[model samples]
Target: MNVLRFAMMAAICIGGFFPSASSDALVGDKLYRNAHIWTGDKKAPRAEAIVVKGARIIALGSSEAMQAHVGKNTQIINLAGAFVVPGFVDNHVHFLVAGSDLTSVNLQSATTPEGFKNQVAEHVREMSANQWILGGNWDHELWGGSLPDKTWIDDVTPDNPVAVRRLDGHMVLANSYALSLANITRDTVAPEGGVIVKDDRGEPTGILKDNAIELLMKVMPVPSAEEMDKALAAASRAALSNGITQVHDMGYDEVGGLTWNNLEAYRRARRNNALKLRVYSFMPLTEWPRVATYIEDNGRGDDWLRWGGLKGYIDGSLGSGTAWFHQPYKNAPDNSGFAVIGSTKLSNMIEGADAAGLHVAIHAIGDRANDNLLDIFESVSKKNGVKDRRFRIEHAQHLSSSAITRFAVLGVIPSMQPYHAIDDGRWAENSIGADRIKRTYPFRSLLDAGASLTFGSDWFVAPLSPLEGIYAAVTRRTIDNKNPDGWVPEQRITVEEALRAYTSANAYAGFMEKGTGTLEIGKLADFTVLSENILTIEPVNIPNVKVLRTVVGGLDQYIADEGPVDLGTVE
Candidate 1:
């Protein structure tokens, strides 16, 4: 039967009609009314009310038309003119790590050497001597672009072993104590895909980039089950507060370890019925065999928690001067950056994962990395027969003009983070030069070319707020306010476009479009209510808009205020 017919019948079965004398008609558990709702559905794009039953939308229409679904048990909530839209879906995030970062040191905005040291010093006082101090995500650019050395925090953290990473997650700064614990010295050889910085005296400066960061992981403490659970809860609350009901968790992995512990934490939450949000988890690409075996035995999980996707890295990030590029960096002259994984190995892994029927998403930041990944994906598709392989390139940040059209032609999704565009805009021009920077984060160009674009926050590296992401995508404004007219104004997209990227497009990216992503009968009742109409407001004001409520699976997961008293039923 057609969708319309199915919806109409479901609506009648819900409460509009009673076919049996013995069984009472089903009624909406909750009715949200008197609001402007953007359904994210092209066929029926607007609504004034929604009736939710159990975990799905029972009916949606004008507030007057929805009164029929109300019964004595129905709790009615008056939105009072708030704007509601499909719940925001973050396409990429390091969920467990982001949760840890929430309670860790606050160094992302430490602008001065003194402040950075003081922050670390203050944090150390709260912990024991042997414990490792992690999760700083500091940005040296805030203090004029000089990389942090161990010396800056070694004195303050004499007792604690400190190992904090740069905001990009590509570089790490270890204190003298941490370096000693890891036995890393000037004599320590940097791996082929990593780097270790040294001073003129040839002493280790405690800065490790790319694969070299693994050296310290050997001595680091693995989080206990309790800690992981706490982190998961914190991360869920943060996401819900930001109107994110679903997140595509880009599972963490490195040379030494995988994210099995993190995945288990999610399972623990699901079992306990404590998972307040939806999760689509991805394992490391190198572990494709394990993923395939698990899928064959257990199958991909339900909507609340699912897996069978693999995430791999092609190169490092731009801020670390490690993003692989075809041309040398303008400022660094001779440095074009290196790949984190060899092309041959990366291609083999992706091909193997695709053949195993597992979803594949490779992280590609620089122009060279993106183009090379696209080539590999194209080749892999031809080698393996036709299937519903939704190959994705995460963080397709920088792209050549030629690579933009290839995304549409190849049916490859460019899963990106718009916040990065504005955050990097402040200094991106200096890194790649004016000529190449023009095409950076070509959101408008990609959409115009017919590529399915999805947006995310990248979490710990960036804010988890989709509202701020929308503002950045629509205004193209730099955080420093240096670009009031927008850093790359021509690349700016509409608020609706940005909203779609955060909503329906993201759901489609995760292969959850049919169940969630939009407000329609029989679909999951997942959405967010805002204080203002972002679609009708100024693009610059988008960031200021507040998330008043977040509903997941027909349940109110977050309420900005104490919440209104239910009016019993809509009579």
Candidate 2:
């Protein structure tokens, strides 16, 4: 009974003084004032007036102590001092392909080959003739190494059928009518793990790696569930205009699929209110027996769509050299990247998803897939004994200080992504060389060995912007300013430890550290205001800050207008 006396006895039992007088008192509406907040509650204290109510956070502090719960129809918001925090919690995303790669054709800034065939001839002149031009992440190391084929986008996709995908969904480029609608020739063959990058006249030069981009993504064209509920309402309005209320998502699937049943398009965007972010899904460990029978019949749901973990793939990525390396690839020396599961079937599926409590994650980018996922999570915690099953690993990136002390003696987590260490520290020391790129994305040596770091933005393979992952974990520098004393500057970290690994170690790796990571009182008024002071910036201006507003539970989803706001009642 002490978190500041349980936040002043839950703000005096939510202001009606205890007896639960039919519990109705959270309508304080809004106050904000003189702002500063940062209450990712390391024992709550930092405030300067909060109040909010009809979505929680009722009463915070000083602005003459929250102007006595400001009422006169509250609604104040004078934050002339900006800064706020919390509302990040991305943890990893893919949010229906980062909102269908925001209406496709980016090709991650096509470097050349006539800028990837003039962006596939302006997405095949605004696509149509049998549609299917689809997303293009593409990255032949930002061109120069050339790779993409089907005669460099088959004369600007001679009548649709593209495919693209390489910024590490582990390869694919496709063209000649998507390799004759996925018949992928030159005697196809290249599955277990994967690779299809061929050329020298054996025929099919459209590349195709990893489970051969599932055979040309199973003949393209699927979308509908109202085109995946309009790409999950434009990926929940670009994840609540980048304050990201909450997401973890990552290959959701409810089975029987040509993909689009992202848990029934997030349960029909939470029954049509068009869900403004709060998912948690994961599944796709090749759909773990229909996600263990839909978490044994809809049990994990609460915070707007939760399907509880499973993910998989212990290898692949590091910008598509298909990561599983212990050695080999210092620029592909007889290559070494394989293992997408098979360490005795990833220790019998992590001892049957830790005896069905489930929560696996896995991915594991190189250092031999983080030493075969810490030797199958320490042989499934010595054959199913360690209880608190928080097990993760996903991109524990290229670790090996004895796999960063087996992620703090096997509690695991490490769900990292600090802008993939400033966008793969520009060609990851040419693919794992400068002495294992000094233990790549180590994040202050996995938080000085106590481990449990979370933060993510593996979104469309980077850029969901948690301030560009807190400016790539406080500037381990490199967005082409070629590593000015950083790239491996002892694993950077500090912008308050990259905002507590993006808000309280990603809300304790998604079990949501008891009601959304931080900001006390009664918790949930999800935050994020900042138009500066990413804790007094200059860590390369924390990727030029700026997210002016973005509350969640306590409404005002994403302000940012900078001026006029009297939209009284729908104008």
Candidate 3:
């Protein structure tokens, strides 16, 4: 998706769909007709046309019925039988980091050893000698099972300090120069929940796993406010172009580095009226006192930017072989994954946040981590009394059969990334046995148990396309294309259900359903126009569907083909 550009007045013809009317006018801000509109409203379900006044959807019905709202100033649009749905609201993302990734080295496709070095070398050649090379989400699993070393990039980037992360963000490969800056030597001891890979002679291999990456983080140069602002702006335009109207920015790692700077950037963006998407952010859970004070001082923000939750981790990512599973990894038999933090400390943070009227969103991938979190939620509810505390378990990837129903019983939101399911499904059989893999990302069971599953793209971890996310959820097919019948096919959901997860379900989880999720009479005019009918299209063809247009608050944000519609921004 390209960065969205705004326009006040322009004309486009779409197969002669629009009537070239009297020079000058329409009363409503915008009129979109001839659409196969998926309203996301359970009561109506579909619509032929929609009339917008300013930022609100004033009316939606048959095209003829909506004509009453049109007048001299209306910027009418004929969809030419295009499909329309509410703009996606991603429930979980590391927004600030995602912004930075957009400008960093492209390594997500570096499948071979030479491919990785060449991509980094190309990026290095464009940068100043002293500039640090970062944000390469390289996946060694894509190639062979071997990991990378600093030696790979040492010759290509001798003058640069490089720290490129694994696709899952749980590990990083730092160049020799970066290791020297972090003072990481052969004698440096690894932290409790982390590992520094070593060579045959016990020398550091320059690969730091999980918490051990802190050594490099401590030495990373903080991005300036100007840099953060630029990144945020880039992210907003990209997201808006993709028809994402809002995002739940799950916290970042370092305070003044990416995480804290993100909060400041969000504030600045909101103040400047540059925040294109509604953002609900979380602070680090371990900083209980600071989080409490910030919440007390700022409260949950308005419709645009909010802070009402704390983000935490129970285990590392599955890609890094540290997901806290009850059983050991099939490939690494003797090792059941370790917890990212102690259980007692996690409980304290959850309790403190809840007591201060905040929600919790913890990253839990393994079955043991899921069970552990369920226990914590149960204790919190028992102690605090039953309330509408929409506590979320991020990446509830692996679950026990009984645990699936517990999500509904306890009213915990499984804020999951379906993209991870398809991505991980590729090599996951080797990570955990086929038996455990059967229950991994149990989307179908969770729905059957009445759990309102919300979907998101872990952005920098995966592509941020909700269309791809929906495709993965509906098909359950692995990216390797090996599972044509779908990986764990029983877990597949319908298109409607997947769409709801991307839009309305996300809004409900974020406490903003009544305002923006669905295309209703009073809802915000945030919607996307697609080239194909997603609801009626062949399930496999949905991923090929392109977003034709995007509108937020009655304004034209993106247009794939500006054929024959009068493109104008509402005043």
Candidate 4:
């Protein structure tokens, strides 16, 4: 009898003996030939062909060897000398927000006062006076050190009250109308973990930082379910087009009305078959009660949409000077930074979440915050008797040498954003001083200690391009080439290492190592084709490498052609 027939007979017997065996049937599908494949499985080198049967890869090798899995009715696709690797997995992202932001007011390119005003004016003109104008990712660094004050936007947004967030999401700029609606005044006391930037007269200047944002955001209207559905659809398409097959989405809060309930919207998209990428949704720490109930009642979803983890912030971000540091900031000597959750509270939360089988991904940027979180992780693991709970330190940006070692020992994954290094490296030293700069985004040190490092682009805070992230990690140089030898040169990683972090490590972080990450047999078919081989390019050129095509689930979803599109507009 043939091996297939023999296996089927054995399956039938096993099914007779054990009723569950009926569910474990293998069905063959098709094959893909004449392609150069990078299987990410370190044991295997590049292969000339691969075979797939029913959603999963069945075999991989030379074309002649893999042909055994194909039948007369099987379909085949020729890669035409294109490179195929595992689909890019983004370890951390706010996918729904990214999609909505794409359609929101774009302020990333506002280089001058005039440019910023013009963009806001255009957005205001399009919106009714009652409607809010949201989502402008303005960065003062890009604007030649000129921070936008209320006066700059007050004139442009006369009718519509605007609340535009800074690129980092830790700070916000509100126009006069919005400020009055929230009843914020110069006398308003800065909340414990927040700051209300005031002018010389101690009057509110329309800029709210960190926890202070709550003072105003509490009053803004919430988006409807339909609006959220639209945002999610847009986000899903964007993810697929960029070759992002999976995302570990850190969800927003319920009280703010931007809750993880958006999963309902995701469900609707999935039912309509509009969801093209897999999303591992995480509940915000504040919504742990709801998450616990949801877990008990519904359990996790299938691969496309699953509730996998819980996300919380220990501290704010460096850009806004809210990161909880051990020492006071170099620019602001009296301020040592603030913590969103106090150390004691954070420890208890981690412990509770760990006990519930929910993985914890915490955002800790400053040295003190990172140290405190490491201590919390250690304490929780020790008490819980660690199994396979893959705890993550989201944006472990700044760390002490001792804290770096704890990550590996405790089996914590550093869910890092590489682009932050390239962007922040430009001004990080100025904020913390040269003495403490060595420990910033210590990618090499973390990897050397055997701690799994995953790469991501904290989208909206930075661009969500894995290619750009790979370039940032490999080169370790700022965009303007300020550090010719590369900033923190010793911490720089190789192109291969960066690629692994972007793919396999990220997949492992999301508990999807078995089904994806590696381009091996039995894995999902997802990969990106680049204009040039990233492996062969010089590190500096990695950022400029263009994406030629993005494939997902054995389907070509995005292809960049050389020809222009017909927009039906006259010259």
Candidate 5:
């Protein structure tokens, strides 16, 4: 019996347990062999070949062992020693917005004030008069610290009503035409939890922060049904190209009808079988009833598209001087930032949503916000008598030492974006002092405290590339190249750890770990093949590693040389 047990262990390591009892009768639909596979399963963490039947992995083992399952019908795919891992799952992304940004003015690379104005001017020339120019994704830090004002582009965009967003999504710069259309002036009082920047002469600077950006919504035009479809298609192609098989789509259009349009668009795509990537959708927390009703009517959707998660914002962002911190920002002595939503209201919403059996994911950027959110999550879970309620804190950017530990204790997942660490690290020290900067984007600390860490792109604000995110987490090198040795070097995590955050950890965060996230039998055959093995290569070269092929549900979604694959016929 002991010898049998040892033999069983070896068989398990080489050939994973078959999905069904009668393993000998099973045959593979596709045989992918001659590859370096990171199975992401602890028991059998490596494999040389995978036998996929339909949309699920039937077996994974040594090339020789898997050959037994490959019958006459199996289509052989020789990987030629390419690196393979579980397909990336971006834990947080505004999907439709990213698609729109791809076609909008390209201002993310504009480093000078002249270049910023030039890009907007060029976009204006292309668009007809009265058309709204949106989705700039401009970074003020890239062109010194001065924020762009309406004056900067008022002359260039005289006819177009421009309302371009800051890269962070916490602020917007509206041109004079847009302000007039919205009826917002120097005298217009900013709404609660928002701010409208004014110049020295008391005139509006066209910069709106937090809730203030909503004022422009009334004047902005709603996207047509056709436009939304195109955006979804564009977004899917982009996600597939990045090797992202799944995304936790944080719903968009907060002011104009609030994601009803976005949700419908996704549904339409799914109905037509147009979705190339899986989506786990989250709606606004304040609208819990709508989401609850949706779940009741649709039964939480299928594996391709799922819902029943609520996303709420506790505060703004650190870059916008709007994160609710415990201490005042070093640059702004009198300001510590404020919560966008009141604690009592936020708690009530969270508790109500929890009672209704919905997943809750709140956005908290500051130390105070994280601490407060943790308290609320703990309270809600306890009151609701917890049953696998995986509460998530989006952008848990800053945290108190206690908050870090409390995440593990309360079983809250920190859904973080690593690129923010490097992007914000450029000037984070100037905003917050060195002391506080030590704890910013502390991936290592969270992992050390036994917290489940997840990674995402926050795309449209940042690029949607998991490789770039992995590089950021492992290297902590700012894009400015100022940190040769890494900016928060102490907080740097290993490449595999970052990959897990992007894959299995994100899968767990979205409650999809059982079906996907690892190259194991009975799991979905969603994985990415890369040109280089990121695990063995130097961390700095990770961003350069190319995604050679991306497969979703047994179908090839993308190929490096040919872009998105059109599976007219499965070979």
Candidate 6:
């Protein structure tokens, strides 16, 4: 018997925990040869060919070796020296929101105040007056760092109520109409972990930060089931096109967390064959009791649509000046940042979730927040007795040296977004000064300390492109080109390391490593055919490495028409 068949039989005899890859069970549907394949498996990291049978990778080796499984009816595709790697597993993303952002007003490129207004004005003309204008990921930092008030957009959106989020999703700029609809006034108090930016004479400035934005959440009408389904469909297409095969979606929305509603929408999409990429949805940790009940009724779900961990915010975000920090901000002296949930309650919530057998993935940005969350995770693990609970710290940015080392000691995953390093590297020193900046997104440090690291785009906040993320990690080049030598260049990693973080590492974090992640025998047949070899290219040119083709589950999900390269079903 062949090794693949022997392995399958052994697995079945051992009660079949790992997926079986029996030769007689499924023959080669397609064979891709003549490729520089990065397997992402350290044991056998490189391969020249791969055979796909059904949705699983049957074998990977030299071109001559893979041919042994090629049946008469099998289709063969010659890669012609192109590069192939495992499909990108983005560790953090907001799925439905990313889809909506695609069709929403394009404010990401709005360079000037006039440009921002013009984009919104143009978009307003196309929408009905009753429809709420949403999703303009505007960044004030690009346009001189002056936060625009309602007055800036009040004139253009007179008929429509607008509540647009900032690029970070930590704050919202509400028009006067939206404010009135929410009944928000100058006297309205901001929530504990939120902020209502005010103007002269203590009047509201239309900018709501962190939990303050939640105050106005319920004012807008909830999207109908049909609308939810449409958004999810758009998300799937967007993900597949970007070469993202799976996403550990930081699922749920601000308004009531929208757990069951969004879960149903994902289910509806799956039932209708509209799901293009795998999604592991996470619920808000604040809804612990409710989410536990939901999990009890639904279990952890399947491969296509998974119920991941409980997600909670340790604090707000850096851009919003609410990320819980140990020291006061260099820019804002009075601010040391505040926690979303108090330390005691935060500990309780995490412990309860951990005890319930749900993995915890908390959003911890600042040093203090990361430390606090780590301490809680340690306590919970000791009390519960560890048994492969892949607890995660989302963003895990801006850490102290102790906190960085603790991540390795506790076996906690530091779920990081590299694009933030380059983007924030442009101006983060101004907020926390040069001293504290050394510990910011310490990728190299984490890896050296034996800690597992995963990469994500934090989509909508950052573009959902693993190529762009890899470029950021490999180059550490600031977006502004201010740091040609790279911002904190010591933290920069190699292309192979970055690829693993984007694929295998992220897969391990999502508990999908057994079935997917590496392009190994018995793994899911999901891979991205690249236009150029990212590993050999100049570090700066990595972003130009286009995703020529994205294949998922033994089927082509995206094929670029711009190129004349013929990737085909050769019989």
Stretch of 10 with least lDDT, candidate 6 = 12-21
lDDT of 5: 0.88
| Model 2 pairs in collision | none
Worst 10 residues of 4 by lDDT: 12-21
What does each candidate score in C-alpha RMSD?
2.6, 20.9, 6.1, 6.3, 3.3, 3.8
Backbone clash numbers for all candidates listed: 0, 0, 15, 0, 0, 0
lDDT of 6 by residue, 148-190 (tens): 7888899999989888888888888899999999888999999
User: Model 6 scores what on Cα lDDT?
Assistant: 0.84
Mind giving the per-residue lDDT tens digits that candidate 1 earns over 245-330?
Answer: 99999866542234878788888999999999999989988889998998998889998999988999989988999999999999
TM-score leader: 1
TM-score of each: 0.96, 0.36, 0.93, 0.91, 0.95, 0.94
TM-score of 4: 0.91
By TM-score: ranked, best first? 1, 5, 6, 3, 4, 2
Of 1 and 6, the candidate ahead on lDDT is: 1
Question: In model 1, which runs have C-alpha deviations exceeding 4 angstroms?
Answer: 1-26, 254-258, 562-565, 569-571
Descending-lDDT candidate ranking:
1, 5, 6, 3, 4, 2
Cα error, candidate 4, residue 27 (Å): 8.7
Residue by residue across 68-128, what tens digits does model 3's lDDT show? Answer: 5566667778888888999899988877887888889979989898999999999998999
lDDT of 2 by residue, 1-571 (tens): 3553455545532422222213235335777868777786665547776766777776676665555555457677777788888888888777787677788888888888788888879877877786877677777877656677778778777788877677666777778887888787888787777777777778878877776677766666667788777877888777777788888877722111243277778877787766776888777665566677777887888766787687877777766777878788888898878886578877787678778887888777888878877887788788888688888888777877788877887788888888878777888887778998888888888888888888878787788878888888877787888887778887887788888888878888878787777887677888888877777767787777778778878887678777224323110
CA lDDT of each candidate?
0.88, 0.75, 0.83, 0.77, 0.88, 0.84
Q: Name the 10 consecutive residues with the lowest summed lDDT in model 1.
A: 15-24
Worst 10 residues of 2 by lDDT: 15-24
